[model samples]
Target: MEPVARAFAHVANMLFPRGCVGCDRPDAVLCPECHALFNGCLAQTLGTAEMGRWFACGWYRGAVRQAILSWKDHGDEECDRPFSEVLCSLAEQAGLPDHLGNVSREQVLIVPAPSSLASMRQRGRRHMMPLATGLASYLCARTGMHVRACEALENRGTAGRSVETGGTVQRSQRLKGRITTRGKILLKNKAVILVDDIVTSGTTMRRCVDVLSSQGAEVVTVLSLAHTPAGKPTKAGRHFSSEI
Candidate 1:
């Protein structure tokens, strides 16, 4: 059965080659040009927010945005590779916190922002898990440290709301108290990094930090694929208004 499946896939590929996720160029998952574009914007951290220091590969634009959108909305799971490569590079460049680096791989864990159950069901996939798992793999491979992803966070049983609908204030208010951690509190005294696709206003990340801190997890840092550049003087400090 496996051989037959492989054969069919091979034939399908021959008939219709996969295009670059970022640029829609044929015959590659992600073209070199797009990869370089994202690589150029690597940074140690985006900005200091109430949640903690945030890091990102670059602004969510051009190829980066296309890659995320393809993976997140269209189920192009392979898109995670390039995205993770940049993220892992950022992690390496930024370096882990002293305490976290000193700890055994088994001690450090990556907690991804949870997608609402309804969204997960609708997509038939757990989006954050893939990114987190990819990042964990990269961290382990690069640093020889064990990295575990904890599905310890849970949505506060509210419908997943769009970040764009309301103004920053309204969005922040809507997200407040809408997410929580569940089951065993593994974060207690453990080093944890929160992973998300993007960070704009830091409201959601702050809320997550609040929950994790209450659970006693030593929140080391927060990471995102992209942070919206400071827009034209919005009331909310900097708004990650664009999807990176």
Candidate 2:
């Protein structure tokens, strides 16, 4: 931000006195205590062939859940920078540098998981674009490769609540024919890393992977800010399959 913008922001904060998204502590978007929850994040090897591997900053629960909801749905756009920082931190921890050691920047594409056109319009922005771009810059600096953030996948106008907000089976069925790659050769034979704000039933991520694969992109893994917890079996030991 420029000096003028910074000054304006400081004045605004003083007037509004924002609280932490998680704990509502004054003047913090996310406090250290809540932010600490994302450290040492675990990778969940979901049962999706296309997803290969999936990783997240933390499990979506408690403060994390509230924080994500606030940013994703309520137009808390200020959280974008902090969230992008967390994602870059996750990438650093996951040794993405080593993974791209051999591939030129041109051969690597950081792909944002597509949001519906409706959702983008509702939010007034492509929410994941900045985060993906930040991650691409990090990969470029670390690996000395010129990486690009490719908005390759798109969601067709499927009329219904998303899987994250509706029944899993029905949402999965609705998502099946809705995602596809842009008709371009940019992704052909390039290594791609998928980025999303959250992963619930894995439906969205898998659909993205499938479309990218169809476009001949080599999707290596997925990086997300959070994933819904895989809780205990509902009944008769039928676990909630993350790989819908």
TM-score of model 1 (CA atoms): 0.79
Residue 45's lDDT within candidate 2 is 61
Point to the candidate with the largest lDDT. 2
Q: After superposition, how far is residue 152 of candidate 2 from its true place, in Å?
A: 0.8
Which regions of candidate 1 fall more than 4 Å away from where they truly are? 1-14, 40-52, 97-99, 102-106, 141-144, 157-163, 232-244
RMSD of 2: 5.0
What overall lDDT, based on C-alpha atoms, would model 1 receive against the true structure? 0.67
Per-residue accuracy of model 2 over 92-195 as CA lDDT, tens digit each? 77666676675543488889988888887776678888888888888888877778888988888553435356766766787888888866646777889999
Query: Model 2 compared with the native: what TM-score?
Result: 0.83
Clashes of each: 3, 1
